[model samples]
Target: MYRLLLQNALRPSLQKRRMKDIWVWNGMRMTEVDRIMLGLRQRIKQLDENVVILEKEDDRNLYGAISLRIIELELAEILALLDTLNRTTSNYHHLIIETTAQLQDMMDTMVALVKFDKMQVIKKEHENQQIKKDLEKCKNEQKATLPPPTLSPGHCGLGQMVNVSGPKTYSLTAYGTSYSFGAWGRDVNPAPGNDKYWLVVLSSSNVYGHYVRQYSTLSTLLLGLGPTDTYISSSNPTTNTIQGPNMVMYGNALYYNCYYTLSICRFNMTTRTVSTVALPKDAGYNSKFPFGILGKSYDYTDIDFATDESSLYVIYATTGNFGNVVITKVETSTTPVLGETWYTSLYKATATNTFMVCGVLYATRYIDKETEQIFYSFDTKTNEERYDLKIHIRKMQPNIEYLNYDPRDHLLYVYSDAYIVTYEVMFQ
Candidate 1:
C-alpha cells in the first residue's frame, strides 16, 4: 500500500517537471519573437518615413526614382501583413508566433532593399553613357553652327577660329578645302624678343590620304606650315593621320610622336627645321612576348612635353620585360643634348602610365592594392629633380583616360571611357 502511494506522488512530480520544460521552450521562442518583431517594427517605421519624404519631393533625378520604388514595395508588404493581422484571432501564443513570422518577412524585405542598391550601380553606369551621348550630340551641333567664313585662309580647312577686331566680331577666314578634322589655335611667342604670332595646327583627310598642317598665322593668310617644304602624310593604315594635329605648345616649340616607331619629334618655329629625338629602343619582338601599345598610339597621342621658351623635355613610354616610361630633358640652348639621369619607375614598366597637364607631368601607376597617382612639377630654374606629390589623389581626375586643361579659364576637362567631364581646380 505504501509503495503504491509513493508511485502516485512521483507521477505528479514528473508531470510538473514536464510542464516546466514546455514553459522554458515557449519562453525562449517568445524572446526570439520579441527581438524579431522589434526589428520588423523599426524597419517598417523607417520605410514609412521614407515614403512620406519621397512623396513630397520632386523626383527628377535618379535617387528620387529609386526611393519611390522602394517605398511602393514596402507599403504593399505592410498592407498585406495588416490584412493578415485583422483576419487572425489574437490569442497570446498565436500572436507571438505570427509576429515572429512577420518579422522574418520584413527581414526578407530588407534583403531585397540591399539587392536593389547593387542593381542601382548598373543603372548609374547607364546614365553616364546617356550623358556622354548627349554631350557628343551637343558638340556636333556646336560644330555645325559656327559662323561661315568670309575668306579662304589657305589650303588647310579652317576650324572654329574666331577673329575679334577691337570689339566687333568678324567671320573667320575660311579654308578652301573641305576638311573634316578639327584644329586648335594658340598664340606662340618665341623665347626672348619675338613677336606674339598665332600657331595653328590643322588636320584633314583627302583622296590622297591624310595631311596635318602646322601654319604660322601672322595675318588672316596661313604662311605655309612645316618647313615650307616638308609635308606630313598618313602612315598608319588604321587611322586618318590628318585627323587634327594633337599639338601641345610649351614655350616656343611643338612636340608630337609618330605611331609606328614610338618616335617623338620637335619643331623649332624660328629654325623651321623638324628633328627627331632618340627613344629607348624596343627590346625586340618575340611570339611569346609581343608588346601592345595601349590607348592612342598615334603621333601626338600619348606624349606630353614640359618646357619653357629655351628647353624641351620629352616623356614617352616603351615596353620590355615591364613597360618603361622615360623622362629625358633636352637642352636646346646650344646643341640639343640630354641632361641629367633618367627616372626609372619604382614599379615595373607595364605597371604604370604617364600623362602631362598644365605644365605638370602626372603618372598613374599600379600600387599593391590600389592605383597610385602622383604629379611631378618640372622646374626649369633648378635644372634638376622634378617635385612629386606623393600618393595624392584628391581634387584631380586620375581615372581620366584623356586630359586637357585650358589655362585661360582654368577649366580642366577629362574624358574617361564612359564620360567627358569638367572640373574647376583650386590652385594652391
Candidate 2:
C-alpha cells in the first residue's frame, strides 16, 4: 500500500523528469535502480531476522546462500554507486571500466546465487505444502481411531501445537501504513457489552499509541466500516498511552506496556482510569532490551503482554536476567498484579515474538519475509523447555509488530505491517 501510494505520487514528477531530458529518458535507467534499491532496503532491514533463522537451522547450504546474498547486496550497492558517479574526468575512466566489469561479473554470479536461493525457498514451500496435505489426511485417519473418553476440550485442554496456517488477512488498518507498527485484535476477555474488535496504531513518532479504534465485529473490521468506538487512553502521549506493540484487550480494558517505563499499564475503558504495576528486578524498558534478532530490534518492545487459555502473562527481559525472557502471570480480574513468575533461558533480544498456549510459551524467529518458524518453547506447566519444535508460521510481512493468542477462538491475531491477520491454530 505504501509502495502503491508512493509510485502514484512519483508518476507525475517521474514523467516530467523523463520529458525534460532525452538523456534522462534513455540513459537514466538508474532511476529504476533506485526502485530496486527500495526493495533491497527492505531485505537489508531483515538481515537480523534472517541471521537468527539461519543460525538456528544450521543448514550449511542456507548458510552459504546467506553469505552469497550478503555479497550480492554489497556488490549491487557498489554497482549502483559506480553507475551514478559523476564522470568529471577520464583520468580514472579506464580503471573504472575495468573495476565495473569485474564487479558486474561478481554481481551476476551473486544474482545466480540469489535465484538459486529463491528456487530453494519455492521448492521447500512446495514440499511443506505436500507434507501438510499428507499430515492432514493422516491426522483425520488417526482421529478416527482415537477413543472418546475425554473431558471437554478448550484452550490448554483442547490441544497442543500441531500446525499453524494462513495469515488470513482480515483488514487494512483503520489508519493506513504510516502507522504500520501497531496492534489489533478482539478483546480476549471482553465484558459482555464490551465485545468489539479493537485496533491500536502508533501515532506521532510511531512509538506511543494513545488512541484505540474499535469495530463491532470481524465483518465490520474487514469491510472497512467506521469504528464504533474511538477512545484515547490519555490526552497526553507520554502519560497513559501504550509504549510498545505488545498489548491485549481484556475485561473492558486495554493492558499494555506503559510509556517510557518498565511497567505494565491497565487502562479501564469504563472509567477511563489507568493503573500500573512495576516489573520485578528492574526489567529493561524505553528501547532497552526488545524483540528482534540481531541489530534489527523493534523499538520499545521491552514489555510484551500475551494471553492464552488460562490467563494473561507478561513477557519481558530484565537487567538481572541479562536480557533473558522473563514470564510472569498477570492477574487481570482485579487491579493488575503480577503473579507466578517463570524464568527462561531464551534471550529476549533473540526472539522476534512470543505467545502463550496451555501454559506453554512459544517463541518465533524469521524463516524469511513470508514465513516465521516457532523454534523455541517453555512449558510453564512442568517448567520444561524445548528448542526443537519446528512449527512453521505463514506471514504476510516480515515484521510482526504485535502477536497474541486468543483463547476465545484459538486464533493468533497479528498486527504485521499495519495489516490485521489471524491464523488458525491446528491442535494435536
TM-score of each: 0.34, 0.63
Error of 2 at 276 (Å): 1.1
Those runs of model 1 whose alpha carbons end farther than 4 Å from true positions after fitting are 1-247, 270-272, 283-303, 307-311, 319-321, 333-336, 346-360, 364-425
Assess each prediction's global lDDT (C-alpha) against the native. 0.40, 0.75
* TM value for model 2: 0.63
Candidate 2, position 11, lDDT: 60
Residue lDDT tens for model 2, 1-428 = 32344346446644543343344345444454445445444543454354445456656575667665764565455345333432321224455588899999999999999999999999999999999997896466445323322311334566656667666665676576787788888888787777888888887677888877788888888777977655555454767777888889888789988877767888887787889888975788888888886658898888988988768899998888888999999988657988999999899988899998877888998768876878888878677787766667767777788889988888999988878899977775
Model 1 scores a C-alpha lDDT of 0.40
Per-residue lDDT of model 1, residues 254-343, tens digit only: 454443334455555556445665555752111112212344222233343443223356654445524444556765542345565354
- Count of backbone collisions within predicted model 2: 0
Model 2 segments more than 4 A misplaced: 1-155, 233-236
